[model samples]
Target chain A: GIQVEQSPPDLILQEGANSTLRCNFSDSVNNLQWFHQNPWGQLINLFYIPSGTKQNGRLSATTVATERYSLLYISSSQTTDSGVYFCAALEGSNYKLTFGKGTLLTVNP
Target chain B: SAVISQKPSRDICQRGTSLTIQCQVDSQVTMMFWYRQQPGQSLTLIATANQGSEATYESGFVIDKFPISRPNLTFSTLTVSNMSPEDSSIYLCSVRTGRGNTIYFGEGSWLTVV
Candidate 1:
């Protein structure tokens, strides 16, 4: 029902660099999450932020529900951070996540 | 937080044969979700399984291709029927504790069809 779009389809960063990823949804959402898909293909939840800002180590996320968009920030990136970062949302109570295409980040050492 | 275990962490299947993937949750949950992640892609919602009720699948996915069964609150199974190379991807199961958004996933089942 809702559409999710992610910006910067691909990114290349040097070790210790910083970058920002954005996700914009077409409809209102109550549950929004940032996930990191590692090389092994495990979807690791980074933050469950429907609104406001949250920081976890070097990764941080901010969601502006009113604007229907969210931003993910990765500071001082490491090679281990190389993978695809995805943003998903829950439009209704069912809470089933509708995911964005994702932002692929490659950090070269 | 919930700990999830998926049977046969990885498998190799021959085309035209079907395979079942099992998802087990340590604690009972009201909502269980099935997802597929293709190579170099993001997660795609396959369906949402609720205990004692039928699963609601996404638009492109069909019941005939991916049949899901949630007989109980803590267990569910997804069967890929008449598998092909296109079905070769990573299938994952996740659960929500009912607070709404916090969804956790298992390690995932890697399927390779030859």
Candidate 2:
């Protein structure tokens, strides 16, 4: 079983701020995903980056598989982004995800 | 994108009772997963359900506590047996599909045991 660790258990920022959340894995992974859990309990898939970099609007993610680490970047954060950000990693071919503790982000308007 | 719908978005159960949560997907998928998230905690994988096969449970999770049935490709059910106050949490249904084997989750079934 692989372990996923997310940094900065909590974060707060103004509406126009930028932030970076990091996820470190204890072992190699075949799939990595970032998710956003809104206040209403909807888990939204933010990115599916197993390697390389991907950008979606103001949110971007980079996974360095060789280094066993991934980074999620949010630019000009908004109040809508106030929620829990989770990073889950899947190892081997089991298709099971090991999730991190999550980073709680609060963007003040 | 996969559309996942879960029944009984929220519920309250009594100790020693059981409740079954239903998960339905818009498209047929081979691999479906059940996850649990305790209050203010991260998600934990409970089991992996595949059509026509017994689900594979993760460590610390057993079939007796969380039984899963995947009768077909588009539907599955998870039953929490002998519920207790400690069992209060959010149970989510997820599926992996399309390119990159991306996973998508439903709105989750929030359960509170009293």
Candidate 3:
């Protein structure tokens, strides 16, 4: 089983600030995804980057598969972004994804 | 992208009772996964549901306690049997579309056992 570890278990960012979150996996992964869990417990898919780099608006993610780590960047963050961010990965042929403990982000308005 | 209509957004049930949460996907997805989010905790995988087969449970989850049914590609049900206060948490269902492999989750059903 692959272990997923997220950096900065907790984070605080004032509105209009920027932040970076990192996720490291113990082994090679067949798939990887980033998600945001809102205050109301809704899981929002942020990005599904098994490899390479992707950007959506003010948010961007990069996965260096060789190093088995991924990073998520949020620029000029907003209050609505306050919540826990999770990175999930599936090792080898396992379709079941193992998730990190999560980075609890608190964005002050 | 597909829309998932999850019922009973939130509920409070008495102990010893059971609750079955339903997840209906707009598209017929071959694989659906059930997850549990405990209070102040990260999401944990409960089981994987595939049409025409019984769900494969995770290490701590068992079929008797958390039974899952996937009768077809577009729908699945997860029943929490003999519920207790510890069972109170948010239950979510996610799906993967064919081989593309990015999974998406529903809004989740919040349960409070008392």
Poorest 10 consecutive residues of model 3 chain B by lDDT? B95-104
DockQ of each: 0.75, 0.87, 0.86
- The better-scoring model by DockQ among 2 and 3 is 2
True contacts recovered per prediction: 0.77, 0.83, 0.83
Clashing pairs in 2: none
Chain B: TM-scores of all predictions: 0.96, 0.97, 0.97
Q: In candidate 2 chain B, what residue range of length 10 has the lowest lDDT sum? A: B95-104
Query: How many residue-pair clashes does candidate 2 contain?
Result: 0
Off-target runs (Cα >4 Å) in candidate 1 are none
Model 3 per-residue lDDT tens digits across residues B1-114? 768878778999999999999999999886789999999888899999978898999999999999889999999999999999999999999988775878889999999999
What is the C-alpha lDDT profile of model 1 across B43-87, one tens digit per residue? 888998768888898889999999999999899999999999999
User: What interface RMSD does every candidate have?
Assistant: 1.1, 0.7, 0.8
Q: Write the per-residue lDDT of candidate 1 for residues A29-98, one digit (tens) a residue.
A: 9889999988888788999999999999998999999999999999999999999999998888777888
Summarize candidate 3's per-residue lDDT along A2-48 as a digit string, tens digits: 99999999999999999999999999898999999998899999999
Cα-based lDDT for every prediction: 0.91, 0.94, 0.92
- Candidate 2: tens digits of C-alpha lDDT, residues A1-109: 7999999899999999999999999998989999999998889999999999999999999999999999999999999999999999989987888999999999999
Q: What is the lDDT of residue A74 in candidate 1?
A: 97
Candidate 3 CAPRI grade: high
Candidate 2 lDDT tens digits, B1-114: 899999889999999999999999999886899999999999998999978989999889999999999999899999999999999999999997654578899999999999
